[model samples]
Target: MDAAESLRLAARSIRGHKLRAALTALGIVIGIAAVITFVTLGASVKAEVVGQFDDSPANRVFLVATPGDDGGPPAALSQPVFTEYDVGRIGEFEGVDRVVPRGTIATSALSRGGETVARDQVTATTPALFESVTFREGGAFADASSGEACPAEMAVTPSAAALFPGNLSVGDRVSITQRGNRTRNVTVVGVLADDAGLNPLAGFGSRPRFYLPTCAYDTVVTSPTTGTRQNVYPQVTVIAANPGDTAAVQTRVQDYLDTESDAAQLAPGSYEVSARTNEDIVERIENVVDRLTQFVTGIAVISLLVGAIGIANIMLVSVRERTKEIGIMKAVGATNRDVLQLFLVEALLLGVGGAVLGVPIGVAGGWVAVTYAELPLTLPLVWVGAAIGIGLVVGVVSGLYPAWSAARVDPIDALRYE
Candidate 1:
């Protein structure tokens, strides 16, 4: 039969038993829908990760201090907390880049107006620390006119500024508490629009970094209150030699700590130091999403497999019901191939119809779900193309055995059937 006639006949056959055809295609529809939704969601997550980290400015090395090493998986290591001395020495190695030390004091306090306040971010650093980061702010701590009287100078982030009273200008006094017991008076020297956002939703990292100028940090440490003070150990952070040299800069930092720092063991197996490129964060996120998509798609594949079995069963019934018709066609001019093609064409049409209908439904559903639920939408062209190809193959392959069984029926016996 010609292509035109085959398609027309296939359409008629499907129309003849529309209900059974619909029931059989139902499994395929559900399966393809599931695969499309999950894969798209995973791809969207990957795209978001890339958008966030691909052009970031922060250094990627982490120096974590822990207890004695238990020789097992690469878990936490054993070392005392890193110190200013360790941070300073990291800048001397071959690949070494500039390092910034970060520390935090989480607390709640009242502004001078007796308003309740809470802040969890405090970084003790110099004017250089502010310059090293991407700040959306009026300015960093150096610009603040914090004298000795207000030794606890803090740069308030825009998010924190909202909790304060009106006329909340720079140089306002806010009483901040540390560890819930100490309510120390801190200066609001500068206000940053946003320092960090952990998610697309406006959330902050540990109360937005409140800063103390390096010059007065020691004095603030020694004199916590009017007279009391405590040593606040700083967490070490490094900026790359440049934007592209994150890996090289991380190596230099590790080398410097190994040869020069007092805690030599920290450079070895005693501490956890991690180096990452901006793109590395995206790759990690994509990996997670891919795993989730595969899990969902596996369930969908089972449904498609069941649908294929239904196609086979339905074709067997079709061949049996029309046995005399087949015998008459064979006795005339029809070849075995023509008889097989007729059955195959009908099965192929079912898949082609499903693909034509299913892909758009899947795409539309993706858009609606993403827009309403606020999920990012990302299109991975390669995965999509692969899915389309898979659908075509499934259609042809699922039709094959049934077509073969119908063609193999002996004409004499088929003619004698009741």
Candidate 2:
């Protein structure tokens, strides 16, 4: 018999035993579905994380202060903290476009009636900060007018505005109480839209942040030891002159910090300066997602192995039950290759049928899981093709032993048996 004739006979045999064929393909269907679901969801998660990073300014770099050996805040008096002067020096470096110093103060916001609204961390920063960070609904940073000693203008987050009795808007008054029972009433210059997805601070339970001019922040919140106003920045953000200059700018900034005058005041190894771009963070997240995808997919491979074994077992039974039929085919001028092809084609059909049902189920399962987890839906076509290919291979390999056994039966002995 030719190849086509063998395939036709295989299809007829499978149709005659519909229930048995379906049962044998069940393992394959489950295995493929599991693999596709996990792989697709993994891809979606990675994409969501990377997309968040992409939304932020790519050319901006963050510089954070290192803690002391005891895990406490670095000695404020001994260790050098970034200030406006330091920001100026950093900005002077080649390829540096701008530098914004950020200071954090813990305070409770109050209404005009003296009712407490919420306790949150307020950031004291330069107007240059508006160059990098995006606001949901605002124009520019409130001008702290050049030569002004202290400006009471402030920008409050949407979450912070919601805490007030009525809707908060520009030109409103927000009273805040700082440490040492000092209270300051500041004018609302702008309302900051929530960019939680793109802001790293959102991860640390950052309550509604209120932005204040650095000058006003110093007047209300001063250092205890000095008893004088000073800029004690815990973090500084740097914007590169151009997108392509980010790497060079980062290196120059780190090198400048090492040799800057501020370094001379610090004890050796008491503090360190580090800088990172958004791309660095994205790469780290991708690495984590890739490892997780591989681990879960490994488990799915075990399921496919079990399905392959089931296919082999069922093919063996089929060979035993059709022993007389095989002998009759051989007597009728069917070669061993023809008999082998017949069994192999039947196994292939089982795999193809299972994949047809499994792929859609896998897509649906991935969609539901990703939606529950609040991740973007990203279907990976490459993985889908791979899953189908795997099913086909498993089906063919599973039939090899049974096909060989059926082909080896002698024509004479088989024809005499009942």
**Backbone clashes in each candidate structure, one number apiece?**
3, 0
Model 2 ranges with Cα > 4 A deviation: 64-89, 101-126, 132-154, 157-168, 171-188, 193-236, 256-274, 412-418
Candidate 1: regions farther than 4 A off: 58-81, 94-97, 103-129, 132-137, 142-151, 156-181, 194-236, 241-247, 256-272
Structure candidate 1, residue pairs in collision: 67-78, 224-228, 224-229
Q: TM-scores for all candidates?
A: 0.73, 0.73
Q: Could you list the CA RMSD of all candidates, in the order they appear?
A: 6.4, 6.3
How would you encode candidate 2's per-residue C-alpha lDDT over 1-418 as one tens digit per residue? 6778777899999998999999888888888888889998999988886777777777877665564433222212222355555666788988888887767666755565655776756777778876545555554455564766577777777776777777567878778787666788887877766635224423322256677887755523233334444565656778888989999988887776666534323324656555657776567567778888999989988998898998999999999888899999999988999899899988888886777677888889999989998787999888788778887888899998999999998988888867
| Best candidate, lDDT | 2
